[model samples]
Target: MKKEESFSLEKGEANQELDDDGKPTRTGTWLSASAHIITAVVGSGVLSLTWCLAQLGWVVGTSFLVVFAAISWFTCILLTDCYRSHVTGSRNYNYMQAVKTNLGGRKYKLCGIAQYGTLVGVSIGYTITSSISMAAIKRSNCFYKYGHDKECHTLNTPYMLIFAFIEIIMSQIPDFHKLSFISIIATIMSFAYSSIGIGLSIAKIAGGAYPRTSIGLPTRTDISNMDKMWNIFCAIGDMAFAYSFCAVLIEIQDTLKSSPPENKVMKTATTIGISATTSFYMLCGLLGYAAFGNDAPGNYLTGFGYYDPFWLVDIGNLCIVIHLLGAYQVMVQPFFAFVENWSHRKWPESGIVNKDYTVGCFRINSFRLVWRSTYVILATLVAMIFPFFNEFLALIGSMTFWPLTVYFPIEMYISQVKLRRNSFTWIWLKALSFVCLLVSLLAAVGSIRGLVVSVETFKVFRSMS
Candidate 1:
């Protein structure tokens, strides 16, 4: 059979087909792609998005969300275009493979390292945030009044260790095909949580349970004119930083069975996923800010006072844990592969166990055991020490996310389009590249401003106390 025919046949098998080497073929239906993309995009960002929006009021906040969505959508399209242009024809053209081939040696390695680092930072942030949310739920009046006294409002070291153990075991399961099913359920739960919470908050505002804040044009008190411009710019930057996961998107594309055609399925799925996420962010932000008014909490979802009727806060916590675990698996898998490859390169005749041990748990191989042990220990120490999920997330977003999402994409565009002196049709790509760079820079500044402001505010409160 011709190679093209073999490729087509493999595509027909979708995610189930294995190549001669026993690797699963990347072909997948729209559902699989959508699930992977949505899960990748929706992480701990959903938790604090509302608070960011509240700072600008609902109208402005929603507007900001729309603009951000457009930019993200455009960026994704451009990225897909780049992938199609540079990497589609080759049989081995996956995301990282494409980067290695198109961008060449050092750039690919640097981007890969940055990508891995960002994912690890994000995973740590999510784990810590989820634990805090769980603690908060336990401390709520409902749990304390109704649950077992010993279980309520207690942070038991043993329990945490057990939880960590369970998470690790669950994460080691080899059936990645099942991830799509799990992601679908998680996405549904997220939608339900957002809908119910936003609806209830809106109802309360309408029924006069909470006073509605004026939502017109900005005022001097809202922020100085100079600060308003800065805020708007910063808001855009924050949104970019929050949504930046372009590297992950490349992975999503590579997972498809055939090279993605410019077909309806890909277009429709991408549109729906991006639109829904942006709308969810906007609604959650507006209603949350409106609900809290001037007393709006810094963490939108959790800080919204009163009980969540659907037990959403709890479910949200669980989802965060699950999502983080998945992300951690993806982040670590590459390093594991690299290490195994290195060992095999040195000792070419070793048993498969020596090479495959990195993929699973077993002490016969010291590398697997030592690395996993180190990760767990370091992650635990960080979570225990810093413990402030929001600040940690902000820091990661500023340092790691901005670099990967904005800086890398701009660099990729410049290398692929500008350096090649590509056609005039590529002008918009250049414009977008510039916009991403500008947004990333401004976001770094805003995040620093926010951190400093928080410190100053804390000092004032302490002095007063």
Candidate 2:
């Protein structure tokens, strides 16, 4: 068989003319793009919102959610235009490419470290979250078999390995454009778990046995003033993490067809996706906090809010596992593509790195097979080593939120449109960026402190009940 025929990324596209970037022709619509966005944006982070909301109280927590969503939406609009270069009118295949094109120099390198690092961190976070959901399912059943107060704890290592094994196989998917079905299913699972959480919260609130409520900060007497400050910062970090998904916006947009123009389609998709995500965030955060007040658990579903409805809780957790399976891929594919593509360029003649074998209908690359599997295993190891869910989420969110989500997009947009320096729009954008930088710094500090406390009290691979 011919080399081209044997190593094609997608079948049936060998005969078609390549896209402007010499890749397969894109067939994604706004709807498909929306699905990908929803899958990537609305993820396991949603489960932690109620705890964050509880810490921030009703006023600040709710306000932060709205503010973060608006910021993410606006910056995403800026990023969509950067998908295609202004001077060359050529497509920027990924976020790094978009940054390099518009904001070249050392900033391009900085964007890469931040973007890819965030992607890898997110993958590890997902692995940890999926494993927790799996364990939660087992514990939920144990509680049903025995009682809610019974000692029923499960180990997360085996579940993390199971999740890793599944990802190793799914990571064989050739390209981002080929992930529509997975994204669609993951998006459905996201909605399913989110809806379940909201429903459970509503039921709890309606039962009229909820905990003490608060209006400003959490009113718990056990929490010290410094602890309250850190919690508030960490909560803001969680909200920031919940809303920001710009890292993958360009990659998702790349899958869209060019007839209606990719930028316009992506803008519409961003609006719709962010709108849907924010609605879920608001519903879950508000209702969950209302349900449990200051004592809301970090994970609404797996945190044992309702043990009576054991079956429903199991289903909700299963949905989370399934959803993370896909969300992991959606977020990590770009990182995979970056490393694999670079390896192919660097060692064009190395068979192990460049060779692709035919496995039925799919073309599997040797480098992809080895490296992708290795990456998943390493991520699983990290997940097991430090499975601090809320703290980990906040840390990753705080680290990447400013540069990747806010600064790069804003700077790239300014460069693309040639906004005059110190003008009203320039001043406004700079001020926004500056404020977000502070938020990110504070969130990072809070997350680090939380992680420190967690590490001091916990051992490696500690199982939870």
Scored by TM-score, the top model is 2
Put down candidate 2 lDDT per residue, 35-72, tens digits, no spaces.
99999988877989999988988898888898998999
Candidate 2, residue 122: lDDT: 92
How do the residues 1-465 of candidate 1 rate in per-residue lDDT, one tens digit apiece? 578766665454554456422576655567776776566566666666665564566676677667767866765665554445543444323345556656778877887676667666665665565565555455454553665343344462333454456555544433334356666765665665567557766866776767445474345475677665555444544455456555566655555555446233555566777877777877777777677664455455555324544265555545555555554454444444445556768877766425444334432454454555566666655555444444556556655544555555555666665555565645655666566566556666765565565566453212110
Off by over 4 Å in 1: 1-17, 20-22, 82-88, 91-94, 142-163, 174-178, 211-238, 259-268, 308-370, 399-403, 406-428, 448-465
Clashes of each: 5, 0
Model 1, C-alpha of 236: deviation from truth (Å): 5.2
CA deviation > 4 Å runs, candidate 2 = 1-17
lDDT against the true structure, per candidate, is 0.56, 0.87
Evaluate model 1: give its TM-score.
0.77
Minimal lDDT window, size 10, model 2: 6-15
Q: After superposition, how far is residue 341 of candidate 1 from its true place, in Å?
A: 5.1
